[model samples]
Each structure stands twice: as C-alpha cells, then as structure tokens.
Target: MSAVTELSIVLQHDIDEQYQYQPGEIIRGTIYVTLAKPTAIREITVKVYSEGNVSWKGPDEQVYQAQEVYVDSSKAIVDTTYDIEPLQLPQGRHDFPMDYILPENVPSSYIGKYGNVTYTMKATVVGANSRDTAISSEPFLVLRRQHIPVLAQQPLSMTASRRMLCSCSFGKLDIRVTLDRGGGVPGEDVFLQAELKNQSGHTVTAMQASLIMTTVFRAQSRSTEFRQVVSKKRDEMDVSRGEGRRWTHVRLPLPPYVPESKLEFCDIIELDYVFQFRVEMTGGSEVRLEAPFWVGAQPQGLEVPNNEQAGRRIHKGWTVRGSQALLFPDGGPGDGENGAGDSGGQQPHVEHDYDEGWGITLVPELRNASEVVTNPLYQHQQNHVTKGARDIPEELLENTKL
Candidate 1:
C-alpha cells in the first residue's frame, strides 16, 4: 500500500512570464509533494525535455514514425544512497527547487497534422511497490529569434508572357511582378510593383496576388506536401489592346501571426513561402508567375504585447519564428476578432489540447531520458494520399514552367 496522498510540480520564476523561456536561459521551478502519514520514499526525480515526433500511415496501411530529441535532462532530489535501507519522512509537505539551463540550439514549440515539437517539466515520486507512483507535468512555450535582414537582401521578381488570337491576333501580353524585398517579420508591410503590357487582341480583365505557404512531410519511403494560401488580394481593372498599366507601391501587409518560412530545425517537416501573381485576360487566356520569399523574424520587445509575449519569445514558435502557429488555429489570432472566422465562414476546424501527457510514471528508475509523448492536437489518424511534387525553385522564378 502507498501512503502518499498528493504529488505536484509547480513551475516558478518564468524567464519572461508564465513558463516562457529562450535559448541559453536558465529555468527555475519547484516541486511540491503532500503526504497523508509518515512514509519511507525510495527516490524523487524531476525532468525537463523537448522533442519532435511524426507518425503517419502510407497507401498500404503501413505506419511510418520518426522522432528527434532536442533537450533532455533529469535531476535527483532525494536519494537513499549512504544512509540506510529505509529513508523515512515524517510526512506533511516538502518542496524541492529546480534549476536547468536551456540549450542554445533548441527550436520553438509546435503541433502540426502529422508531427509535434513539445517542451515539458515532469516530476515523479516512488515507493517500495514501484507499481503505484505520483507524477506531475507542465508544458511551456518558447519563442525563437530570427534574422530578417539577411534573407531579404535582394528583391524577388518574376515574369510570364502569353499571346492570344481571340479578338484580332495582336502580340504577346507581358505580365511582370516584383517585391521590394523577399523577406519580413510578422505585422510588417511588404511593397509590390507590377507592369502589364497587353498587346494581345483580348482585353485584360483582372489581376490577383497571393502569399502562399507550403509544408512538406518526409519519411524513409516517400514524402508528402501540403500547400495553402495564407493571404491574398485582387484588383479588378480593364486594359485595351493598345493600352498598358503599371502599379507601384502596392502594400501587402504580413499578418502578425503568419507562419515563418523554411523550418530549418524540423527534419520530418519543411516549410517554404512564395508570392504568386495571376493575370486573367479576355478569351480565357491567363498568365501566372511565382516569386519565393521568407518569413523568419522576431520583433522587438517594445513592439510585442505584455501578456501574450511569452518571453516575445515564440520557440515551439522557433523552428521558423512562430512558424508552427500558422498550422494550428488556436495558437494565434486570425483575420476575425477572436481566433476563428477570419475570411469566410470556411475557417478550418481546430483541435484543442488538454492533459497532453496524462498518466502515471511508467518507469521509476532514472538514468533519465524522461518519456515519449504525443500532443493531443496532432493529426496522425487522418489518411494521407501521396502526390507528385512540383519543381520548386530556391531563388527568383524566371520561366513559365510552373
């Protein structure tokens, strides 16, 4: 029979606030335990760690899984090494202070469809039976710092030309689009310039621009991808055969909670961003061009809010500078008032997380690699169909092959 009544782990001294921390920062916390009567304890341990995992099924119903460990460590609070067989405690209440130094290369916290990256602090208490034990765990948020100026060094430009013989068979319609820079932080403005020379017999009806985000999931056998348009704008204008148009200083504001580009740390999943311009001409002729860009930046403390800025710190936000927030609906705000109903009523459903890792300690002895946990918000159960990947360029697109 176990006499222990309660066991809990309370995180204290949040670096920025509410268990939010950054790279190379020290994390300080406490562990609390309450007992019903006098009891003899075998040992007590506390562990803090971060990890990334992916699990999915292939076409033939074969499951594929992969995992990577970021930061994993454990400390022993009470041990009965030299004293004797039975180390007894009078038993009422006791507390143990926790101290851990976070690694400099840790990525942000994230939960996506097929994978997740998580940070946890867990404490365990054991007795003679080892079958019955108490465990408590708490999750924290991490925000990664980004360097935008480097990735946005040069402008990204693209052009697509097409000829039509509908009205009278004139010349090729040239459509070109350019951005002042190819990268930006969230909540910042990106400038755009465009030129349209419509010599084609058919008139130009409308033009559109979109900010696209692509996610790629890779395994040993095959790879899959998910592409989406996070933001878009349309301009309805008319142009005759002899007339042309030029647009300058067109502003495309980047949403503050948009996902960052190029998730460098995550092995199973990779992210990339691009800007697409489409021009629809009369007689069913259209020209489309694409320009790749980046989103990896953390704003200054003055620019961020007080309660929401976990340290301004975004890590599970880190892999790409709050990049994972783009995948989960509840992580950040949408175009609407709250976190949902942004553009149309077609907003995607968001799965919530509660007691992400809720269970008794499976192992009492600690050499310490704490435990393996899957975030409740993951989309591992869904069926995925593999598709052919389009050739994505690493630099500015110069051809109409896409």
Candidate 2:
C-alpha cells in the first residue's frame, strides 16, 4: 500500500471517564481520522497494546529483567473490524464508533490497569495496503462503581490455600492464617494477619511466623528469581486449653512496580502469598502449615521477555524507552470544601531497600555498590523531593538501576 501524504487522529474528548460496571458492561468510544492524500486500503483494524518493565537482581547476581506488550488481539472488548472505503482525494474526517460487551468470564478485578487491573482504551486504524496502523491511546478512569451482587462477587474474597489438613498419627493440631484484601494495586499497602491454635492436647512452648511472596512462573524460569524477601518477624508465645495465638500485626508494602507490571496478562504474575507459622510443644510435637493467599494486579494478556528480538512488535508510535510510576490521589481529599489543604502536609513515602545482590547490573560503569532506590524513580541528590519523579526510560539500562 502507498503511504498517505498526511495522517491525523483525534479523540472525542480529552478524558473519557467510564464509571465502573460489572464485567459485562459495554465500553464505547469514537475516533476521527483525516488523510491529506488519497490512499488505497483494504480494511482498518483496531487494537490496544500495554507495556511494563521490571528490573531486579537474581540469585546469580545478574540483573533479572522482564517486559510485556500486547495488542488485545482477542479483541475481547470489541471484535468487528471496519472497512475503509477507498477515498480518491480530499479525505476530511471520518467517525469511528466502538461498542461491545466485556466478556462475562472476564473478572471485574482484572478490568482496570493496562496489564493487571487498570483499564486502558486504545483505538488502532490499520491501512489496507500501507504498513502503517494509526493508534489513539486512551486511559479510562472508573470513578463510580456499580454494586455487584454480593454472591456474584464472592470470588473476590475466596483465597487459594495450600494448607494440608493436620492428621498426625499421634495427635492433631489446628492452624489457620488469613490476609485481608488479598489483592491490591501496585503501590497500595497490604495488611496480613496470622491466627494459630494448638489443638493437639499439648501446651505450645514457642512459635515463629513469616510472610513471603512466591512467583508461580516467570519468563526466565529461574527458580532463584521466584522468591522475593518480603517482611519477616518472629514472636514468642505460650498457649493452653486449646489456646489461640495471634502474632504482632505486620504490613507488606507492595514494592513499586515499573508502571507496566501486571498480574493477569503474563504467565509469571502468579503470586502465592504465604503466611506461615511454626510451633513446638513439650510432648515432642511439631507441625507446620502454609496459608496461601492471592494478590491481584492490573490484567495484562501476556508478557514479552526483555530481548533484542522483541523490539519488532510495536512498529508504530515511538517506544520512548522509559519506566513510569503513577500514584493514585490517595483517593482522599485534603481539606474540607474543595479538598485542598491550605498548607502542604507530609507526603506519604515508602522506603524500598535494594540489596546489591538482588539484581545483576549490565553496565559496570554505573554505580558501584547496591542500594535501596526509593520510589518516584528520579535521582535524589539529597533526601528531599527536588523534582517531580517521572517514568524510567526503557532504552538506558545503565541508569535503570533498582
């Protein structure tokens, strides 16, 4: 196909906010395109693509990396493609409307976010003969949410457990651990609680507990990368009369993901959240069990491993090559009235310590030692926020240290 002399695309509105609806809600939008010169094209195809990049060190001390980009080929949202009638000359603007119901099986929890749970709306226009496919990227914000039936949304609360029912030949012990809000957004905080009981007719002397994030799969398939050290703390306790124990409450700060990290899209986003507790009694009794939980992320269809060959995917719009992190408005209004405080209050900050051995660095010329790179991915001369943090550039790996 011949290249059109000129190409332009426009959106109906600057920001299109679609309040949250059930998984089957229809997502609709319109796009207008104009061509400067006449061009022959077979049909126009619309598609959406999402991208995410994560950098960390593996056990080998080599930097482990993963990246994913996809064009919702499933057209899971809208399937029909529009035929572009050949235009002879003076092609003004044409309106393209989209209307389709989200798949019923599509979990509402996976609706938002480009990769995991965030919502992304994109419209692509494919030229019949030309290799060019014009695209307009739209980010959808779900403000108001509908009340899904309590039963229909019950799955959101159901958790994946790995605990084995205790059936010791000598005696039996009962133990249960649960983590609330098993799922959360990238930057949101996670609260975990553990409840333990000694029903083996013995007094437990002492116990230990820990919280961990396990990778079910990854692009590299390296066992060493599957485990990420989250938060760990131990406590001593005494129990009697089928007594129960609750450990000091602990919070798991969701590590800041390079805006693109998603749960549903890639096969590797699977996380088996574990809450483990161990106990020992005077009767020479011992038992251990792991309570498995789930953490949901923005849905991404699948992931593209970071490699040179994968660059051929997105032939259109520039990749810019950078990492981006976004912060939700705390979902809280500052002051009363307009929700703006007269004076700036303290900014919520999360401390992320990056131990050197965690990821391998490609460039030896970069920083020397391992360090904890704080969020808002920007260089920090001092501790204060000098400039607003922006997305990390994808091209420059040297500066992309975690």
Candidate 3:
C-alpha cells in the first residue's frame, strides 16, 4: 500500500573505528531506500549540517544563548523524468551514492551539558504524494587535524605550595605534578610523576590525580563556567608531619571522548583541560597543583619514557615557561598547520606574565578575520579583544571578523 517502506543513510568506509572525518578527508556513504511499490519521486536530496549552540541562565534569571553555523549544504541528486513525468523508483532496494569533502574550518563534535557542537548528514526522498516522503539522517564527528611542536612534545611539570598555620604552629605543604609529555591525542596514556611534601602538623590522608575539563560559555558579554572530572586516580597513604612521598611514572590513560584543547572554530563555547595533583590533609584542608597540556584528535608518536626526569624536584630559576600554545597564535603548540610562525627580520620577544597552568591561546592582533592571511586558529574571536600595534581594538573596525 505504501510507496516507501524504509530510508536510511549509511557510510561506506565506517569499517572500523568511530566514523571520524578530518577536514581534508572524504566522507563517502550510501543512501539506502526500500520501496513497497513503484513510486513516482519528485527528487532526492542530500544535505550537510553543522552547528554549535549554548544556553544558560544568569544570576538575574536572564537567559543567555548564542549559536554559530559552520556548514549547511544541500544537493538534488534525482529530479523529474522526461515528458513531465515524475521519476519512478521500482520496489525493493535502491542505493544512492554519497560523497562530500569536509571543510577545513570545521570544529570537533562536542556534547556538553549547557552547550553542544555537532555535525550531521541527511538524505531525503520526495514522492509524488506528500505522505510518501522518506528521510534519514546520520551524525558524524569532525576533528581538524592539528599538530603540536616537537619541542612541546617533551616533558612538562608544575608546582604549587601553600603555607598553613595550624594550632598556632607555622607549617607548610607543597605539591608538584609532572607528565611525560605536554600533549597527546585520545587513547594515549599520560605518564605522571607526583610529589607531596608535608612539613605541617597536619597529616596527609589521601593524594589524588585527576584530569579535569572546564567548559566556558560566552554570550552577549556574559559567560558561565562548568568543570567536570573526567578521569582520576586516588592513592590512600598516610605520612605524618615532616615527611615527603613520591610516585613515579604512574600511568593515567586519557579518555577518548574528551574534546581537544581550545576547541577552535566555534565562538560561543570554549573548552580546556588540566591535570590536577591534589592532597587531602587533616582538618579537611586540601592543597593542589595543576599542569596543563594539549589533547588532540590525531595521535603523535610516543617518545622515550621520562621516569627519571619526572621525579626530579622543581628547583628555583625553573619557572614554568608558557607552552608554545601561548606564543604561537595560529595553531597548537607548534600550530604549524595554520601557518602562524612566519615572521619578519626579527622574531618579536614579548615578555608578559600569563597563567602557565592553563592552555592559553595568545591573540595575534586580529583586525579583520575576513581579510586575507587571517589567523585561522583564532579567527573566532572579536577584533578589539586584542591590543594591536596602534592600540586599535576590534570593535572599532568596519567589518569585524567572526
């Protein structure tokens, strides 16, 4: 009785891993259609869609929301037949080939509590009768293949110290975190060396290492924040006053589901991560330190183990230098993919104090993103956001970049 019984969109090369598409890669699939009888079809169409949106309420109950769309394309693959007759698709199974090239600027898929960024594909068939229309959609992931520097792939560490006065006795506690490398892709393990020192009268009850993700939502000059501990390992050990403990080369495997650092291409939402080393002390007090690193969608080669180097105490004059993710404006730590490091006769030396424990992306003075040779890694920002050579802000520009 019905013209179409089933309609579905299926990928051709999903033979394996999660169906992931890089910007330059091809997305080949097939649209499977099953018709109950001969159907007069007006047209068959395929569409691609990508979007990011954020919604949350401020303290005053004012709802703040914003959305950005990166891709929305449609094509008609089948149309009317000759002699003004609609094309007839015979009963049984029919296959329509699908092919598409993802754009280079597409961001990765991220599902958050208050915000979500996603990419999807849909195919539709229109029959002579409106009731015979059949449609199908499939969601996929997009990760801009990014690269970090060879230098940034090396080991990195950070320290946090706090002085406590318990029972009128001056005491101190110090904690440090070290990782085999500063960055890696999903499914890889991040080797860690954590140290804890307790000169205070309080007892060390527990020590924990956690991978935390922070998601920030910005809209209309307002923003909200959310933090979740994705992975963590806790060690229960007690060492009384005037003692120190250390663990070497403890493996903390990164979860494959987490998003990449900076989450470029989407403007309304920003996500970052931190590796936290925390110690729970007596009297319900806690001392913690965090080291930041980049996690990407593509994997890098594993370097030599740094077990010996990871345990070394962080000494004076060993100030934590900011990762290249801060100095280079266009990409990741190396960020070579975006063509950021090219310079003039002199590579500028800019000395400024910044947070080393956060994956900070520096601004390269974007006057207009629509202009040629723009910062593809950071074009999602507003112009006035950065202080330029002439002290001109982005808000003053005629055609502000997005």
TM-scores of the models, in the given order?
0.59, 0.33, 0.71
Q: What is the Cα-based lDDT of residue 332 in candidate 3? A: 23
lDDT of 3 by residue, 6-121 (tens): 98888754553444566644466788889988888888888889999999998999999989998887766676744388888888999876556566677888999889999889
Pairs in clash, predicted candidate 3: 383-394, 384-393, 384-394
Top-TM-score candidate index:
3
User: For model 1, how does the per-residue alpha-carbon lDDT over 1-402 read when each residue is reduced to its tens digit?
Assistant: 557777877665443232345554445567878877777778887778888877778888988788889877776677664556746777798787655556668776656677767889888887645653688898886545545555465788888778667645447788778898888765666778888887767777888788887777777766767677777767777887767777666777675554456555667767788888988877777788887778864532312223331222322210101122222344333324334434434544443321212121121111122332211111222345558855322222111111
In order of lDDT, best first, we have 3, 1, 2
CA deviation > 4 Å runs, candidate 1: 1-20, 34-41, 59-61, 81-95, 127-132, 143-146, 149-151, 167-174, 194-206, 234-261, 280-285, 298-402
Better of 1 and 2 by TM-score: 1
lDDT of 1: 0.62
Model 2's alpha-carbon lDDT is 0.39
Which prediction has the highest lDDT against the true structure?
A: 3
Superposed Cα deviation of residue 30, candidate 2 (Å): 3.9
Between prediction 2 and prediction 3, the one with superior TM-score is: 3
